[model samples]
Target: MNKTCPNCGALLIKDAWETVETNDNGSYVFKSYLALKCLQRCGYYERADQNDQE
Candidate 1:
């Protein structure tokens, strides 16, 4: 998922990684990795919108 800075409206790139996890019920779940953003200006980061997906 891509995120942006709410304060500064900076573009952020999320490096998602695939991984498997077992729950208490012995169920396998897939999870992706998340990344932080380096906000410019105000040093704030927020999630990007669907329209931002290009």
Candidate 2:
């Protein structure tokens, strides 16, 4: 999947992030999600904290 850069209106590349997640039932599962970013060093990267990963 391609994404548009929010800063320069250019096309961005797609990437995936994987991590373990727990549901309300207390079951743990490995999940993946798509992320988008500019390849030309547009500084459009989104920040994630340690808490956000869990």
Candidate 3:
């Protein structure tokens, strides 16, 4: 959808990551989020908003 860096117009790259944590009952919980980074390395990065479409 024409994703680009606001500062340099470089193409934006999507990265997904997840983490696991232990709960009080010893059950594991997982969380995940999406982030964007400038492909040209212009130091532009941001996490996708909760309502943002992938």
TM-score for each prediction? Answer: 0.29, 0.38, 0.54
Question: Candidate 2 at residue 13, lDDT?
Answer: 62
Over the stretch 1-54, how does candidate 2's per-residue lDDT look in tens digits? 355778987776655557798999999999776655577768675433443333
- Quick one: best lDDT, which candidate? 3
Which ten contiguous residues of candidate 3 have the minimum total lDDT? 45-54
For model 3, state the Cα shift of residue 48 in Å: 1.6
**Candidate 2 vs. true structure, TM-score:** 0.38
Q: Which candidate is the best by TM-score?
A: 3
Steric clashes per prediction: 5, 0, 0
**Per-residue lDDT of candidate 3, residues 1-54 (tens digit):** 668999999998887657699999999999988878789988787887765544
Error of 3 at 17 (Å): 7.1
* Higher-scoring candidate on lDDT, 1 or 3: 3
Alpha-carbon lDDT of model 2 = 0.64
In model 1, which runs have C-alpha deviations exceeding 4 angstroms? 1-16, 34-54
Candidate 1 C-alpha lDDT tens digits along 1-54: 456666667766543345699999999999654444544646443343455444
Question: Which window of 10 residues has the lowest lDDT sum in candidate 2?
Answer: 45-54
TM-score of 3: 0.54
Candidate number with the higher TM-score (2 or 3): 3
